[model samples]
Target: MDIKKEWIHFIENSTEQEQEALQVFLNSLKMKRERKSLTHIASLLQLKTNLVEDKMLEMEMPNSPLLDNSIGIVHGGLTATLLDTAMGTMASLVPGNKRGAVTVELKVDFLTPGTGEKFICRAEVVHNGRQLVRMEGKVRNEKGVLIASATGTFFKLAD
Candidate 1:
């Protein structure tokens, strides 16, 4: 099975709501692509912000050839990217006219190798401060076993 075929299979198996969510995510990616030089690598890897609440976020990505290492496991860098995106997005959701935030420090621990056909990362804001925000996130494979965990500090950007 090639990468495209695998993606098709995953989509076919997804629920209607999940497919709708994916379409919205892709539209956001398209808008971002039109405005900046950003490559949307995370989006290409199928990384998505599936849910966003007050202080919690759910993100997911489908396992694809682009995210695999030579031995057929999820690449560490790709995993890190997923964590960073989820954590950063959670931090940025802080209300008000608080400009934006950037990840000041990110630390990831690889708990287990990811070998499934899907990956999910969940992030929650641990502390939202005046100038800095802290978030913790965990990445898990399809079976719900932790593959990696991360903590990040984001510095609030200027107005």
Candidate 2:
């Protein structure tokens, strides 16, 4: 069967709780499909925050099995991706920044297991230059328990 049909079949066989979980994943997928942008996929996974120009960028996401690892905590790769995203978002807001930045390097320290109802990340630009931006970010739970910390360098593209 095709992927869509297979998804329907799986949903039909799943318990209500499982179906609800699947729905969350499907909702994000649907929104990304509608927007037709990878950026939209990132936005779908995150909640809005006070991430304005030249200010700290914050992003949050709810606890969902779709983002969890085999042991039920958020996956490390996802945590790193979110960290990078937070930094990049802040980089884009730097003064005189004519273009958005792409990750040149990202280093994350998984300080603790990511466990909570929601994950929150906050980032700020440490150094904004013409060609490179450096940012630092931290991820915590809703209860303010630190999960990870990251520092990243992003390369600014030409206008």
Candidate 3:
């Protein structure tokens, strides 16, 4: 059968809790599809770029099963992605510059399990050079517990 019919059949057969999970998953997928301005991965994670200014970027992500691991905590890889994205955003957004940057290296230290109602990532450029930018970021839970810290190096893209 086609995917939509199969999805409807599965929804009809699922238990209440399962249905809720599926609904949340579907809503996330719908949000990704509907929000066209963000990059695909950013859309998938439902990240909101809350702040961007000189040398810094801040983004927020809501707690969702889509970001969770088998143990019901946020996945480490997702945390890394969040930190990298934030750092990369800060690295690339230099005043009077139109170039973008791509990650050359990312080193993440997962300090604590990502457990919270929401998470925020704050990234700041440590060094911004003509060719390379160095950035550091921290992921914090809703209560301000440090979940992870990351350092990243990015190279500017040619215009």
Per TM-score, the best of the predicted structures is 3
A best-first ranking of the candidates according to their TM-score comes to: 3, 2, 1
Regarding lDDT, does 1 or 3 come out ahead?
3
Structural RMSD, model 2: 2.2
Per-residue lDDT over 53-143 for candidate 1, one digit per residue giving the tens place of the 0 to 100 score: 7889988988765566888798999999989988887887786416768999999999999879788999999998888999999999889
Model 3 over residues 19-54: C-alpha lDDT tens digits?
766766666677777874357678667688855677
Worst 10 residues of 2 by lDDT: 43-52
Q: Which stretches of candidate 2 lie over 4 Å from their true place?
A: 33-40
Candidate-wise lDDT, in order: 0.82, 0.83, 0.85
Residue 86 lDDT in candidate 3: 86
User: Comparing candidate 2 with candidate 3, which one achieves the higher lDDT?
Assistant: 3
TM-score of each: 0.74, 0.88, 0.89
Candidate 3: regions farther than 4 A off: 15-21
- On lDDT, the candidate that comes out on top is 3
Residue 145 lDDT, candidate 2, scale 0-100: 97
C-alpha lDDT (0 to 100) for residue 124 of candidate 3: 91
